[model samples]
Target: MLHPCVVVSGVLLSLAVPTIISMESCEFSGMPGMPGIPGLPGRDGRDGEKGEKGQPGRLWQDKPQKGDQGEPGVMGPSGKRGVVGKPGPKGARGHQGLPGEPGEASHTDATQQSAFSVARGTATMPGRSSLIRFTNVITDFNKDYNTETGHFRCRVQGTYYFVYHASAEEKLCVVLKLENTIVASFCDHVQNHNSRQVSSGGLSVYVRRDQEVWLETGDYRGMTGKPEGYSIFSGFLINAH
Candidate 1:
């Protein structure tokens, strides 16, 4: 029988594989392989034309555009005056009143006596004597004795006043009374022959309708004079008030 020899294959089985080989060690290395060739740039594509605008939408046609803001509006005008109202009617008249009755009489006391008759005396009170009493009637005109009691009664409610004058050739004395009480007394024992005039104060007294005020004579025995003219104790009975 003859000896048989077989061969072994070392192929790199790849579609795009770089060929390589196994080698024994070398003393020096060879130069590196050349670089790959540069490739050409690709061409740019053309731009397409714009399409026609679509038909106006409903919102685009209907919506209002904002207008330029208008100038600030002019100020408002003033209002007109109102009409005057009508006047009211007049008021009614008032009713009449009834009349009043008369008043009663008035009584008075010592205050209203006359000026000349206030003092007691033997001589006359010149003009104011409604009633008078003389102690001794020596002469009609002689200053012999003016017997003023220096007092009188208040017959009515009014004012009264009393005064007196008295004289003698030598001795002189006067005594006056108010409400029967002695108010004043005077005497001039010396011969100068005093001629004195005295009067009561004008007093305001309110005596009821019919009250009494009395006056009396003194111890000197002088004449008791009446009240002055218009000097009644109760003459104020009229409704003069």
Candidate 2:
């Protein structure tokens, strides 16, 4: 039973020298065939040591059915700066926005002044109520009127305009106060006939902050002899409510 060891086309061609095919009356032996010429295809071995890492690829749902989305894969060489990924989850508070449409009216803040004062030389208010001491400052501009305390301080709160003038050799009267409250008056008369009297008056006022305006002479002794500023007092700041 050993002569069948040299099988040719079934790929085992070795051991060709032992020929004893008999086990007590069951077969005949050896030597009578002639078709032996086809043996040349045997040299491609040695690539078999990489089989231990094949089990980690079957975990995407044991996947074998998803085979059509694979044509976008040739751009993969820019991946080395990936460590800053922990701050992205706080964004939801935006909806109270609809009240913005009223802008264009701003006035008053350059010190807020437009003032005036006079009486630079010849003055005479010598009979009792005397505060008409505007030594001369034709426009105090935010100095708020303090010509040696003739007084007009109302640093800014609204509508003001004041004016005054007086001259009388025989009679005169003047009044214009805003803190003690008399707001405006002036008078001149020639009852006895020296006849060069003049008087003036002006007032348009709402004035609030600090509040103190002036000009007082009422019994009237004004001669106004030289008459440069002409015994006058003036004021301004007409709109700052």
Candidate 3:
């Protein structure tokens, strides 16, 4: 036992000496690698604080500001006129015309072919003698005679003419009978020894148409001269109005 204990004590002492040397070297070296770079510069700092509030104020001083002017607006329309006035006056007149000529006649002249006769003691004479009367050709004849002096008148109105000539019997003379009396006469005896007496004249008579007219013998009172009595014959012409 005593012999090995001495060998063992020698070995443990030799091992403790090396471990102490390595630890000492590591401690003495100061930390091992290079140092790092520095950081960027910082931003500028903020401004200072606002000012303090003002005191209370009036309404006029606190009023809002005026807005900008607007574009121009459109224009308005015109008004109507009042009522009108009264009427005007009239114009002048015109001129006149010229005169005209005379007019023509309607009826022509009429004539009888032969004499109309009034027999002795006869009241009415022939009808066709009315043909001389342009008015009526159908009526009776108007006649008159005087025992004193045989004469006649034209009662109707017209232009009358007489034609007288003697027959074989006696010296011929005529009296105009109208309106129951004698208006005219031709008692002058024959100028020649020959038995025929002839006379004619125009008379303007104012008798109405269709009225009567006649001729008859004369009353020879104072005559120692010729044949015993006078025979009458006559024709007439009538013109119308």
Each prediction's TM-score against the native? 0.24, 0.25, 0.27
Residues 1-241, model 3: lDDT tens digits? 5779778887877887787987986766577778767779889999989989988775585669899999888876876876676656665665665666767865532232112332222222213212111111222243322222323344434565544333322343445666556667655554465444434333445455445555544542111112332233343435534
Q: What is the lDDT of every predicted structure here?
A: 0.37, 0.71, 0.43
Cα lDDT of model 2 by residue, 122-173, tens digit: 5544555776676767667768888777788887889988877656656667
What candidate 3 gets wrong by more than 4 Å, as runs, is 1-157, 190-202, 220-239
TM-score of 3: 0.27
Off by over 4 Å in 1: 1-151, 192-241
User: Would you list the rank order by lDDT, best first?
Assistant: 2, 3, 1
Q: lDDT: which is higher, 1 or 2?
A: 2
Ranking by TM-score: 3, 2, 1
Per-residue alpha-carbon lDDT of model 1 for 69-173, expressed as tens digits?
A: 888988998888878878778878868867778778677544333222232223443222223343433222212122444223333444433333433233334
RMSD of each: 21.1, 21.9, 28.5
Model 3: per-residue Cα lDDT at residue 60: 81
The list of candidate 2 runs beyond 4 A from truth reads 1-108, 120-135, 142-158, 170-187, 193-200, 205-230, 238-241
